[model samples]
Target: MKKKIKLTVWMITISLLIAAVLFVLQQHSFSMTEQKIEIDTPQGQLTGTLVLPESYSGTVGLVVFVHGDGPVNDTYDDGYKPLWEKLASAGYASLSLNKPGIGGSSGNWLEQSMEDRAQETIYAINWAKALPMIDAQAIGLWGASQAGWVIPKIVKKVPDLAFSILVSPAIQWISQGQYNTRQEMILEGFSEKEIKKREDYNAQILLLLKEQASYESYLRIAQSDDLISKEKWGFFSKNYQSDASEDLKNFTTPVHLVLGGQDINVDVEETERIYREKIPKNLLSVFYLPDADHSMLSKKNASSPLRTYLTAVFFPRHIVVEQYLDDLVHFVSQF
Candidate 1:
């Protein structure tokens, strides 16, 4: 009788453990399918991935994802992969491509202009439209960081884009440069006077960028010994503009703007001002998450040990990833 009781207890424990494991697996389980294809761009053949949701019905909406300033990959290290998975789980097909020279794609990304990049995006859209299971009419562009600048240019060219979603986009690279300069000074314990001088220089740089000044002009103004590197300035000037306000005003597609209030890279307040004042209210969706730093992670109290540690590691205090996705899901669903 004693032996039988012990055996029964062992069986029950094993069964409970198995049940718990299964439950955990179920929570994390999501169906996803991926394929690689070569897309024809004006520059050359671009390699990219087409990810489809599990149990997808025929002709679902497609999301063409454009990465920030990084080499695109088949997986999430590109930063947009997690969101792509979320979109897939929500029953949307997603496509992410390698920028011109990276991955399996061909051509040089460094030499491409904004117009060149926008044309590449249109090529991807055309590819998505050719997929039998994709709803070409419902296709949309989801751009983050630098890709924000790319989206408007693409939409203006394509004119048939269903909607666009921008995350932490640099609408005014000049303002963003100044904001970043100030943040760096504050972090380094610079005096107010020194910081103000830096601010003044940044403002000048911003003006030059806004006017679409030649890269040589930007380089000359940014030549001070105390200023940021010429390479950084050249890259920014080449990739972004200081006066995108006019271009934004011409946009007619539905736009969703998600910004972290505590973001140090961009002037969130100035950005908000432009959106609210310049942009038509009917076409915009804006969400400002407070106490959230650039990456959108929530910050603890200023005095907290965790806050200090995170600050040391330069982690953003904003709840960017999750909050942005939630807002994105809500906004896209409306379409």
Candidate 2:
């Protein structure tokens, strides 16, 4: 009897290990498979990867990813795989393009304005529509951060965009930057005087930006602060002027706006306020993750802004919250 009981325990343990390995292998297979493609925009050609869901057939919906600020490459700074894989499991095809100067794409990304970026995205959408495997009428845009400025412009131009998913979108470009700065300062425990200095600094910098101040003039303003590098100044000058108030109100596209309550970047509260005011009830849907950060990762101490930032940057930041994926799946399926 004792020998029989020991054999049973061994068999159960072996079965559990085999099951775990098989599950991991299945997940690997479900991740999006890459295909090379190129799109011609007004500026130049964008070389990108069209990722199709494994086992997907019979014309799946397409999701085109736009990047946030900076030189975000085709993989969205190497943080898009999990999200894209989740979408793939839900039977969606997705594309992520290398910015003009990043991978095999053409043109200089830093020189492009919001209008230029929007045009690039439109080109990508058209390219996706032409693919034999994609449902053209069901194409949608998915992006976060600076994409908030780009996506609305896209829906405005196309007017027939199938759906959209915005994660931690900013209401407006300049205001969002200010909001980010303030939030960071508060988290770093800046004093009232220090915060006031930043506010004053933001006012002046924005004024110069609005006036289309020369790079040299911006340099003069930056001499007082070392935080603004030459690279950063160039990025701001090129992509800084955008107001989404009109676009937000006018976009009739089905929008699933996701906000992270623990996000330490943009003022999620302010963005939500604008959404409530401008977005029509029928047009807008939402998913709020109270303990998730801007990247939809679980946070240990969301209430403490400092801990939130550190966790997002250094440790355990790559774990995607399950609810974020579920929210996206529900949004995509409904539309």
Candidate 3:
């Protein structure tokens, strides 16, 4: 009788634990209503998601997300939902579109220039503004990484934007690339001599890009295993000159800049300095997260593959710095 009672208690405990896990997963969607949205642009049809507050009666303010880099899909494989949920809770709507050739969207992402990206975002903004459920005057942008090059251009064109949020944005393309390479090398324990050699190679590649050299020209000089594809080369040739300093000066809306101190991909200090020099103090707000990485993920989680996987699977919302999400909501709430 004692053995049977112990077995029953163990079974009950396991059952309750499973039930709690399921409940957490079910509630992960939070209080947001997400819908499949499609936008037609000159480039092609864009597949996207429009997330809105579940219980709001009036039109909500909208935030259109611009991807940093890569062929990212809407929601960034659900990585953006935490942010979406935060926005929803604050009575705001968020829109995110998959890059061209991704998630059934038409055209090719690598074929687009920075200007093309800005124009595509403008198209999304205009489409959202026409919806009766979104307040046109309350529309803004949230972008990161390569988006630093894109968002400022959007701000330049859309002078009346409600606000702009930039995360780990770099000021110049060439310098940012160099910084990333150096930091990554240092982290990997590369010697000074080896680092200098790689930088010299990068300089050569930059010169080729500046000269508009063809793929064949690059092939002749590139190492056998280091050759970039023609498409990637074309992308580099088109955007290697990207510098946001001039475009940032055109900002006419409130801007919130988030920088992660432990970020290796960008020189956050340089980004902050340039932003301060270019944007008026009254229009810019800065948030610095000392323990975060380029993606605003905590250094502890970002550095451990096992921890990253475990956290992403069990606590996806906490994959990034919780404070980063809170700051995003706080900044947008003011508007």
**lDDT at position 45, candidate 3:** 95
Worst 10 residues of 3 by lDDT: 23-32
Sort by TM-score, best first: 3, 2, 1
Q: What is the Å distance of residue 158 in model 3 from its true position?
A: 1.4
The TM-score between candidate 3 and the true structure equals 0.94
State the lDDT of candidate 3 residue by residue for 73-183, as single tens digits.
Answer: 998988899899999988899999999989988888999999999999999999999999999999999999999999989888888899999999999999999999999
Provide C-alpha RMSD values for all models, in order.
Answer: 7.1, 6.1, 2.4
- Weakest lDDT window of 10 consecutive positions for candidate 1: 312-321
Each prediction's TM-score versus the true structure: 0.74, 0.83, 0.94
lDDT for each residue of candidate 1 in 242-323, tens digit (9 for 90 to 100): 3556667656778888888667777777777776676688888888777666555555533255764544333221213457
Candidate 2: stretches off by over 4 Å:
1-30, 224-231, 301-318
lDDT of 2 by residue, 1-335 (tens): 99999999999999999987776555444356878788876677899888888886589998899888778888764467677777888888889999988897998787777778888999998888888999988889998878888888888888888988889888777777777888888888999899999799788888887887776787777746455766666778777767777778757878888999888777888887788788888888888898888767677644556765554344322456678888888788875
Lowest summed lDDT over 10 consecutive residues: which window, candidate 2?
A: 310-319
Clash number by candidate, in order: 9, 0, 0
Models sorted by lDDT, best on top: 3, 2, 1
